[model samples]
Target: MAEETHVLDRPPEGANADWTIPQHWDRYTAEEHATWDTLFARQAKLLPGRASNAWLKGLDVLKLDKPGIPDFEALSDRLMKLTGWQVVAVPGLVPDDVFFDHMANRRFVAGNFIRRPDQLDYLQEPDVFHDVFGHVPMLADPVFADYLAAYGRGGQRALGLDALQYLGRLYWYTVEFGLIAEPEGLRIYGAGIVSSFSESRFALEDPSPNRIAFDMARVMRTEYRIDDFQQNYFVIPSFEELLRQTVETDFAPLYAEMKARADIPVAEIVPGDTVLTHGTQDHARSRAAG
Candidate 1:
């Protein structure tokens, strides 16, 4: 009922910035590993045909079944073989620049804490459960891997443009919470959607949110909700396609244009929208009233 509390810079369960002591992988409690297993098992069960093949393949390549908090050194060894990307530990959400720097260098900063079992379905900030479980698997894919690094570089430029609102939308619509249309139907690829139980279902089956075809410009100008299920989901045709389009086209000029225009609210249906499902948005409205 109240505004979702913000707790930035809170280090994960056993993290410290010394970066010298090597990640004390042996320090994660047994209960903590069980938490990762629980979340991993739950989402693995739910994802089947729902998530993209790249994400699924990533899960296998990462060998995530070894359990407990993954030893970053081991995971990094395997990950480098797949996409040359490595995961590092972080406090919580770092400043935009720090996050972008890590991403640009192909180093993903994951929170060291696992979510409390009770917080499985949701958490205020990204924890190990959300960061590794949600994002690591997809990083194994080469093309999507490149896209993320590029986005990180782009983040730096976008910050300078005073267009973070638009740039953040780019991340919201694609990286964190997005879907891609497969030959069979819409499939989940975005880490944010795949990691949350409620959103996993809401994104694909619920009619409350609009499903629009992915449009770079339209998405950069859109707004998204951070605390709840998104009011809209942008669908891409394929990860490779999604990456090619974004990496090849420079967003510098695009950001310049977006800065001059009004940012679209979460649920608005615009004329140029490549609308897939035009919802009455009853679900979001009902929640608001309650």
Candidate 2:
């Protein structure tokens, strides 16, 4: 079988220092708006019982349910009032420095493009739906908002230390694929899982992946994969706890120590793991056997 390829959209020639561009909202055709409406309506129906309260409330607070693709200006206006964060349109994925710089300054860089109807279920690169819909909702939460800003600052620092992989894992696990334990049960908070129709269900209900208690050291040392659903999802007790652990702890020493250690495989469960749900690995095994 041939490997699938995805060509990511790039910043137009002569993009500014921040690598941002106008959303040009009027440029979107009705078909594009219809696609957004379809994606929004489907996720809205699926998210209620599965998504974290913070995410659900954010969705409401931002008026994301309103018809058509969101106007970035309007979305930013509301987000600024809620959490001092604003979404900025970029051509697509920007350089790491440009990305972190925007986040550090409370500006989120989103692709101005939406996915085509044929590519609705999955797209390898983040389009506006994945960037804004997947990520921006959680930015409305104050605790997670602060953590992201801090992570951005940490990203800047990590760049100098050549320790981005360690920090990127923290993001992949928490911001993208994380879970949270609520009074009722496990709910989705990670944008990667929350934005996906399938992952939102799989991360919590599936018996194929490890669900372990959040541990700063363990998560930093772990590896993750992008082409498929995650093999592990870390569950946090609360956003406040998540913030405290990341913002308060110093990573300089930890980064220095990492040079001496081997990377932990995505599916390996080490000792002292506060094992929450022991995954059966049935999904992965089946895929491999096929």
Candidate 3:
């Protein structure tokens, strides 16, 4: 994994309170662009059979298949026309509130740098490739686009209620690692899975992780681990349904209830779960043993 060099919820010195910086599209070197090409080629090869139709369609619509690192201005032009969403540059991770504010405005904050070639297989911080390739494509799907905007709005509200943790898990399961039930089979849509070549396969084919139907309350009450493949993946029936659940429901009451309840462990398969796949958990056990 790439070293965890990111500044956590705090903005670095001289950064604007929101922690945004220029992408300096002109500054990328030939080596950096080449890194992007290599990673792009690797992911594009695997995505067609494994990714959601919407995600594939979005890739074409956004013209992400063309070549080397995409110019942010050029990318934003096309994205703005499709969904009013645009990519913005950031140094690294931003404060939660700043992140929510950007997303609320339909702006996605991406790291300006690309990982070195040696770091291709893993990176602790999100790079331009992960941000744009993994995430921007989904923004082209209108239903998902609307859902993101709603999630951003919800993030702002969660802040006032002191419930950001509850809301953050929703984003983790749905946006970062969510699966979808397509007519053909379950397909990957979550950006985290889409970005990682190994995870792209592991998330779908591995029987070591539980695949459960999306449950709003359960997702909110669950914890996530950042250092490894997720132990459980939540599958949504459709983007429309996911959007409806998040947009139509008020979360204030839900937050209060969640605070009164204990959190679910990351690897536990609780009762009442709509289990899609009962994982053997061998992968997690093997990792622990190592």
Across 33-136, the per-residue lDDT of candidate 2 in tens digits comes to 99999988888899898999999998989998889889999999999998999999877767788889998999988888888888877877788888888899
Write one digit per residue (lDDT tens) for candidate 1, span 168-217.
Answer: 88888888898988888898888899898888888999888999999999
Q: What lDDT would each prediction earn against the true structure?
A: 0.82, 0.87, 0.91
Q: Model 3 over residues 232-263: C-alpha lDDT tens digits?
A: 99999999999999988879999999999999
| Alpha-carbon deviation at 275 in model 2, angstroms | 0.9
Ranking by lDDT: 3, 2, 1
Off by over 4 Å in 1: 1-22
In model 1, what lDDT does residue 204 have? 90
Instruction: Work out the TM-score per prediction.
Output: 0.92, 0.95, 0.96
Better of 1 and 3 by lDDT: 3
Model 2, runs deviating above 4 Å: 1-11
